[model samples]
Target: MGEMYTTHEEEKLIDIVLDSILSGVVIIDNKDHVIVDVNETAAKMIGLAKEDIIGNVCHKYICPAEIGQCPVFHPWQNIDRSECVLLNYKGESIPILKTVKKIKKDDHLYLIESFIDISKIKETKEELLVKEKAIDSSINAIALADLEGNLTYVNHSFLELWGYGDEKEVLGKPSVEFWQDESKAEEVKNALFFEGSWVGELLARKKDDTDFLVNLSANMASNEFGKPVCMMASFVDITDIKKANLLIKRKLEIEETVASISSMFISPKNIDQTINVALEKICELCGCSRSYIFRFSNDGTRMSNTHEYCPEGVSPQKGNLQDLPVEMFPWWMGKLHNGEAIHIKDVSSLTEEASAEKEILEMQGIRSLIVLPLYTNSELTGYLGLDNVLNTGEWEEEDINILSLASQITGAGLERRNAEDMLMNAKIAAEDANLAKTEFIANMNHELRTPLNSIIGFSDVLSSENFGTLNDTQKKYLSNVVVNGQHLLRIINDLLDLSKIEAGKMELFPEKFVILDAINGIKATMMPLAKKKDIDLKCNINIGNPLIVADALKFKQILYNLVSNAIKFTDQGGSVTIGVNTSNELISVFVEDTGLGIAQNDQGKLFNPFSQVDSSNSREYDGTGLGLALVKNYVEMHGGKVWVESEVGKGSKFTFTIPVENQITRA
Candidate 1:
């Protein structure tokens, strides 16, 4: 029981030393080298319990006892430092650094063994070395220079950038010598020295004395004493980017010039004037010697230059190029007709196919040219040409596209003018034809009604016994004459109504009327016909005591036409209904019928004068097909609209809406 615990003071001292430092500590007896005391850190580091390690022989667990020597040993040998591995509870080797010192406590000899886990530090050091190698191999030119501007260090990338064969070539060279701009070079150097940093684009000279652009960033490095030691810089080559920026600027300018010219064509009062302006702008923006627009003759045998521009030194080819034979340049004309441009970078490159055109172009000192064909209504009408007389260069695809767009814009202007002229002529002709129709209808109404009225009146008198008493056979024939005469009169009236409405001459005479009274009157008049056909005619007046504003005669005519048409088309034993639905804003009327339903496609033309839904039913149904047309015209005259909803083999509902206030009333 006494051996199980150390003295209380010794235990307290052990805890004080163990908790004071981060490293694991263990004390071993001198003779047996067994762990007599262990701290929490030592037990955790070895992955074991403190109780298990305190009584264990140090060499048996971790001191590589079977191999060579123990780290915990007597002071006479003085073994202070060594590194080894300790096996954890799981049998995994954990790397550690070991140091030993002999201590005399309570006049007893013991070995103090202390160590630190160095596994993570070892791994971190290895990763740092790898990253340093990656930095050295980077593509960016990396260099370090002393404060005196002599190169101290440079990677392969830096050596390669300066066209140096080896590091010795640039070891002591002043970095400022590589910068071409003397003033800017001094400015950057001053900034690096005084401000501790500088970054910008500056001109740099190569070993061959050729200049380039570089994006360089430099920083001043310092020692712990706060004195400047050296400078480090990273350089990126940007020579190609500078050149590309200039090219893009030129292209944008050309596009802007072409766009401005296209906008002027929208109100082109004179084609030649607008084209001349375009030629001037195109020649100036494109850096060309001459620009021209040529129009083909109506006979298609020749072309004449209608507009042209020249930049001072170029000869004027506009007048001399007029009326040239089109066949002489067959290849050129062929390209134009196919909507393809003729881009000749050099006239000398033309072969025998273009010999004729080449001779003409060379006579005007034109070495390079681009021609775009212009068409009005898809017919080749003209061509736009740009010529380079002094300088010859390949026309870039972008330049050619801009010129082609210009030609298309010109063609649109021509087409628009032609269309406007045609429309004006059409309007005049339509007005004259309408006037003639108006005169004919007026004369026919007088000439037709005189004879038709006499026939109808005479038939009526004969049937009424006013002239003489007629036999049953004669009366029957006379009744047919009167019925057909009335039908003929109805057709004539409908024609007149349609003509008046189309001519915008229809007038509405509005009057307030009792809607219910009108509905009852229509029902009474239509009852005999419905009874003969055995149809169930019905009326649903949802509006209570409603007084509607509309022309009395026209309103009655609309109701009569709708009811009559519905009755005529409906088969026997079917239903015909008149529904008057009123709202605060308007009056909606529906004439629905469960009849031989109209087809969906045919319903569109129902209100077109003389249009029948089914041509085959023309003989079966006796009508001029003008009733619905007149109904639509009258409804519209009172500021209303009409439409139909129907499905084949089902039913139909014809609806019309009239604003409650039909027209301005006259006192």
Candidate 2:
């Protein structure tokens, strides 16, 4: 290729011209496709020196054409100018704009190739593509508008947010069309134009004209010249968040009111006042004119407004609503009976089926009302209702929930009050019955005791032959009369003592006395009875103290009754023991008997007056059933407790305690 030059100086001149150009140049032999002369720019583009690249095949350095498949040499196709790649010394492909010119100089054909590096232009275009993709995939509704505020571009999220089918539907539309308030939209646009950005919540409308709240951020988009070209905005739907916040606030308020109502019921000052206060709270919270409770009659045939509250300027309806016939409110009462709440948004919306209910409600000046069934133990006893006499206001689910909770609390409180009332009445009736019984026993004491004593004394006199010597049959008959008469007299005395104790008329005469002496006396008196049954009687005085402070007569009576019961229940050849012990400043006395033991089930009734294990007419025991009862009463009067330990077929032990002298004397 150097030989084609006319002179060495001429070749030097051409090299100087090519090296000064910014673009790369290489002259290739058109016949052999081999490089001849290469400029400095082309050498640098291939990362090689001029001497190294001068003899390389043109395809190996700059052109990508394979050997003998030169695109430039083809007759059918022309590659004069094109965007292509240059292969560098490191085998990296560099993008370029290349031009090839076929020229004949000095009768030698050659291809002159020229190219310029375009890496920065390619990079800039790629960056723009990536940014476009990023904006299209964003989650926030993103839109771009022209300077005139007509939409030019919208992302997928924007389509879904505004309920548009596709970009075509919104691309040419004015941005203000999507906003519920056009004036506010204009204000937002003005803010963006003046302030360069605007961020706030605005009401946005969907394609179907349904409005929702959105947090919008708008910014003025500018060109490279720094002139504002369009408005760009991103939107985040905030409708659900707003609603949830409101619901949470509503729930907190309801909870506070419900807690107040529950506290009142827990420790009520008065039921009527509590109900009235609770009604007032419900009415105020519900933003209603009145709140009331309607109760169903026990027979289920009548209803009454038992409790009600009305704010000032409202009429009180409770006085006129008493004893209303249930048949008149068939629909309303049916719902209440089925435990269903009746939430009437507007009384006028009532159909023909509820005409009666509507009439009744409107008569009381109620436009909207919510009546919840009051349940006690799963039975619907009444309804708690709120009336919106001021207007026909809509009721929300939160309101219904509040009313339902209030109804439950009200129902429970009312049920408790009813039970308390019943208990009071029963208590009064029991007191009256006890008084009558005491009076009857008092009358019987005077009427029956004297005759029984006279009968017993006459029989004793006759048996002792005070009048004359009697036959054996006559003597036996007199003995029988004396025994039966004495038993009847004992029963009468026991009855009088029991009545006195039960009526709380009995008094104690506490005195210090030798407890051992009382025990010995009891053993001596009970010995004859024990001997009759062929049973041995014994006394066990195991105590440090021999004295006790108690009612003297009652103490002796307690000992006598226990010892007598031991002797009476002991079988033939069985033994009875009166044991005494002192501990903890108290004396414990136990009367143990080898007797027919009481059944476990019957021991609980032993101390109840007139309660016998075997009370039938033909039972074996002959007790008047008052002796043990009297013992228990007398023991307890001294602030002591009595109990019996017995198993069937295992004998019986009756134990009681009385305070010792040191303890009792201090009292």
**Against the true structure, whose TM-score is highest?**
1
Best by lDDT: 2
Clashing pairs in 2: none
- Minimum summed lDDT over a 10-residue window in model 1 is located at 66-75
Cα lDDT tens digits for candidate 2, 1-667:
4346888899899999999999999888877777898899989999999999877777787757644435556733455557778899998999888877778887878888888998998999999999889888988899999888899999999999999888999999989999999999999988888999999999999999999999999999888998999999999999999999988988888889999999999868699899999999998898888899988888878889999999999999999999999899889888887778898888988999999988888898899998898886667778899898878868888778889999989888987888888999999999999888888887887788887888888888888897899999999899889888888888888898888787777888888888777777777877788888899898888888676788788888998998888887888999988888898678888989988999989999999888899999899878878998999888878888899999888799999987775333211
lDDT of 1 by residue, 1-667 (tens): 0132368987788688786768888888876777888888888987888888778877655656433355444244445556666767777777777777877765677778788888897789889988668767989888888888878888888767778778898889888888788778778878988899999898888777777798999999999998898999999888888789988998788778877888888878876788788888888877788888898998889999988999887778887988888999899999998988989999978999889988988888888999999898999998998899887779878668777887888789878878978997998998898889898889879999779999999899889997777999999999999989998988888889888888877777777888888888888999899989999999988995488888878888899899989899898898899999888868998899988888878888899888887677447887877899999888877778899988887788899999877454321
- The C-alpha TM-scores of every prediction are 0.66, 0.64
Backbone collisions counted per model = 0, 0
Model 1 global lDDT (CA atoms, 0 to 1): 0.83
